[model samples]
Target chain A: MLIWNRAKILYIKKINWHLCLIFAAISSQPILTSMTWKQVFSSSIGRKLTMGLTGIFLITFLIVHMGINACMWAAVYFKDDHGEMFNKAANFMGSMVVIRIIEFGLFFFIFLHIIQGYMLTVYNRSKRAVGYAVDYGSKGSKWYSRSMGLLGTLILLFLIIHWLHFWIPSRFTGVEEVEYNGVKMHNMFALMQTTFQQLWVVILYVLGCISLGYHLAHGFQSAFKTIGVHNKRYQTMLTGLGYAFAIVVPFVFAMMPITMYLGWVK
Target chain B: MEHYNMSLHLKVWRQNNSRDKGHFENYKVDGISSEMSFLEMFDVLNERLITEGKEPIAFDHDCREGICGMCSMYINGKPHGPWKSNTVCQLHMRAYKDGDTIVVEPWRANAFPVIKDLMVDRSAFDRIVQAGGYISVNTGNAVDGNSLPIEKDKADASFAAAMCIGCGACVAACKNSSAMLFLSAKVAHLALLPQGEPERKKRVVSMVAQMDKEGFGACTNTGACEATCPKDISLSNIARLNQEYLIASLTADK
Candidate 1:
């Protein structure tokens, strides 16, 4: 009887151990941990953050690009040596290792922005399984704001064309080198002039610039708002600046192709 | 006030239950006074339907003066009809023409499933609010409100945010069906005052987590929420919510 009692007590102890082990495993299953990096980035807000950050970076790149291209007009100021300033700037940008590294980063951001933009568009569409019977186009928000997906798609196509015209040739092959202030650089100015000479290409370029302007008109203030600039005064200022940027930047970009095509720089 | 009598054709959604597929059923409402509110016109329609021995349409409503935020309707492709910053309860019949065809639907979002014709199970919103939408102080006699000495601008801003009645019109108007405007209004209202500082970090994080978990779509800053808001809630509240979330996430001890 004593032996049987001892054996029964041992069996109960063994069952208790198993129960403890199961409880421990269940409690430690990562459900109790705070949000992970994957959770933060995969959330809807995270996707918007990615879009806004990449957009701001691309906006900055546009400013630098516009500055460099504006040097084409400087040919008029320094008529003795047409496009000297422009060539010099282009050569510096092309040769610098740091700039080249940043160019890669810019490419990465552009692709990221495009991919995330499409993902968001798809997600937004799926949220509305049924379309409204009565359409209120341009009544609730601006047409451009609601049409961001279409505008972005247009920008992507234009970007591919723009890269083929200049970026590919300059970076890879079939580019004549010019001496600018005792330094050799890809002759981007000559390339631009020749590229713009085609009427179809020039027209496409102008249309691309217009699309870009509308995209920026909405995206500029949007990026700021997304990043948490919520004060009324600051919001008003940002909106004003956004309008100016939307008009002036694209206007300048559109002019580059037109002036080159018309031989205004020469 | 001038009253104009009008006859209108109303096509309203009728759903028996959440699981049942819904469709629009047309009803003719005659001799509706221009002075009658939009919900009153619906009341007239319901009276006619009941008289004919048909089941009355079910919708959510309280405080018919527009403060309760229960009245939700998607009228003519716009939430709360074509009038800006107007709830259906406040929308007068005068806004419609003599022979207009008005289509009404419920707030459509995966997060807000339909419970009946025009009513949705918005307990998801209540869950989000329960997550961290309040201060954690012990309940007792109220503190002297004057002792806080909150800045006038801050007070006003908080008041503006507090004006949100939790009407899901922002969600209805958003193309993405995002609850950012509504969530931000709650977050901003608490985050602005000193009383909310104790749990500020935890509140924003938990509420946003709850929001995402509820399966709402992301905000794209389309401005439709602000445009359709009956209380004129600003889009800036969304920006403030984003800021709060970012700060909390970066500084969180976990």
Candidate 2:
């Protein structure tokens, strides 16, 4: 009788564990999916608060990503090494377990962001499908806000190619080697330079960066509002921050190729 | 200063009532003032119509100033008559000259039902507002603005959102016809204030439900609202609304 009771208890425990795991996974969906519109934009302040926070988070991610990629520009400029420094930098980035963990985090953030965006767009579409009587509104809304889905899709496509070319093959797949400066190096720098030198690759990079800029221009201020930071006194400052982020990060990213194309580096 | 006495053509929409079948009526207006407001030019045409023993075309207008948001018209492929940041009533005729053909139409949205020629019933916005758009400030709990001592920045943001005049321009300009901008303004205003704290989650829940119930289109972040809004309300408001919706949903206690 005692043995039978123990076996039953064990079975219940295993079942409970499986159920907990399933629930945990389900609970992590973007919180807005189940919310009412009132909850989404209940008040002007609430609306601004939410948007501001999300925008800032997205902008931060872009800046970090751009900074890491700037190493390519550095590699081109440092000619005597002829790719030695870049190769080391690439290897260092690949070898860092910390960077890998961050990369995973970035992947998660981006995936959730796109999913939430899609859901909002879908819900907005359904609601508008009913009947809208407002004769004149939205005359001042910017194009970036209007075409987020299209731009987001384009960025997503860029991300996929970006991963395949730089992340997936370079890190997950085996590293390729090339000889330079009488020394064999993990051809990561060579790969980067060659990729940038190609017209198509440069064009794609430029397009992606521009899209990122457009996204950030509105996104930064929106994120601040999301966290309840909307106020008149800081409005100009917040907008300035957005512009600064949008312009600087994309400009730096673009300069990498522009510089390379100009033959500023060997 | 460009001067040209423009003989212009117009295909204006005319309807007697919501149940009436609306049709296009053509008219020509000559010697229009280059500096005249778009509505003023319309007044000139209406005077001629009245003189001709015809009932002048009925339209809706409240504050000629852009603040009231009552004047709304779709001009030849653009909302609020082509000039950015100018409401239909504020749009100057100088924008067009020398025999330009214009098509004038009422703001078209599911929520807005046409009541007369170029006059739409935007009461759906009122319905959405009544559905929990206001802050649940308890009676006699008058809190001084300085009592909470909110950060100046938050206060400024709240003021900006509070500037929304409930105009339906965003819907007319939007391809999806989303009211996200309007909804965002309402949401952002209260969310920034401390008095709006206790029932924040419930407020958003009810208001958003009401907006959806009214048949307003979803916000796709196209920003046509910001471009055409006489107030130039920012698209950041919509993004903030999305974040609030997410947080409220996640943090709500069942």
Candidate 3:
């Protein structure tokens, strides 16, 4: 194939010099294409490894995300605190140049995970084209583990709405600005208060959080397993830790919208 | 145990070859003894088909006692049927009662293509094994068993992994048709032993690479394969494979 392409390119060189260069560029590369480092990471197991690594990174990001959002409960500690602490923490996260740069990396990883997740789901589904005539649902495995793709898609949908509510306003168009202790920044607190007023939005966010919980239920230990944490002791610990994280993280996140919607938080 | 006979209706997958578009063909067998193995019931049906001047349903089977992994059947939406840790040849008709409708099919995977009715070509498994073939031993006479001491847990784990018959049931039962369980079983079988030390890294890397080359799907860790495995191959082996491959690939000179 390489020789044939070279011969054709040589023949074309006599007729159209630019065409010959284009043909050579396109055809020659594949003819000599050998296994390289890039191909290594794109293989079946490698693709999963990519998912696992990126998933753990995203998991870490959620900690920061929830911790900062957890700042909304500052009213519990201080007198007449109206999301001031949450707003300041949110501002600190937003205005820092270091975080601003890392924001790109964060979104990049998120996008990579979403795209690769869908790709993996599609590829895996194709592995068994013709399914069994008799349905044996969830007898062999948990439904959530099999439905990661569905749960992930739900999370992605929620993200778009959540981002539209918060990310775009704060980053692109700018949020309603306010001064805390005479230091002026965006009143992301006010934005959250107003965003949760709609009952449908609150319901949707809760559903999103539920989906995220399930996604993490399978994904937390799955990421560990893929990265090679298979020992019985560590596995047992991780399984417990994974379930707790899955439940607590999403439950807290969901509560943010629920509390605001019900006027439980000021 | 008092024995009884039953009538059964079977919806079996039929295909001429890899290129042939397959469909389900139904067959009925009456007076099937409760003690007869599942394949023997098939034999009864095939004998009737012969008398009727119809083509006999072809399948793969050897050593009807279930030691040989040759028997491959997706009986009623599961590899090797309802019984846990049992192959098709060992599955008794006693599990069924009168007028039961049984659906049977070949292992559904791109890697395991249909050769005929209820039979798939599992050469892909052989290739994956061959990819991890041959541990290096200083060619010599047998040494003392105690020469290389191994822990009991490790030996038991390795023995469990070595019990894999390469039946392709894991692939059949897996939603993704992944060969991870089988591949992991092989990896764990060798990596736990002293004989497999020299080529440990090489074996895992090459076998996994070959598994990908065979067009199998990625492991999603659903535990379906472990559940369906006739040898009861554990999912821990898969986790171990993930560990092995991850470390090996990272440190690989390539």
Model 1 segments beyond 4 Å from truth?
A1-34
Write one digit per residue (lDDT tens) for candidate 3, span A46-117. Answer: 788888989999999999999999999896567688888998899899889999999999999999999999
Q: Candidate 2 lDDT, tens digit per residue, B1-254?
A: 96656789988988898888788889988999888888888899999998999978887787888888888788886778777777888888889977798888887776787889988888777545544465533345566767678899889888988898877888777766667788888888888888677657765666666766677765544557787787777777775676666677667664
- The per-prediction CA RMSD against the true structure, in angstroms, equals 8.7, 13.3, 9.5
Cα lDDT of model 1 by residue, B1-254, tens digit: 67789999999999999899899999888999999999999899889889999989898888988898999988988888878888899999999879899999989988889999999877677667656677756556889999889999999999999999999888888888889999999999999999889878877877788888887888989898899999999999999998987777677677
Task: Please tell me which model should have the higher DockQ, number 1 or number 2.
Answer: 1
What's the TM for model 3? 0.91
RMSD of 2: 13.3
Comparison by lDDT, 1 against 2, better one:
1
Best by lDDT: 3
- My TM-score estimates for the predictions, one after another, are 0.91, 0.67, 0.91
Look at candidate 3 and give me any clashing residue pairs.
Answer: none
Return the candidate ranking by lDDT, descending: 3, 1, 2
lDDT of 3 at A97: 97
The DockQ-derived docking category for candidate 3 is acceptable
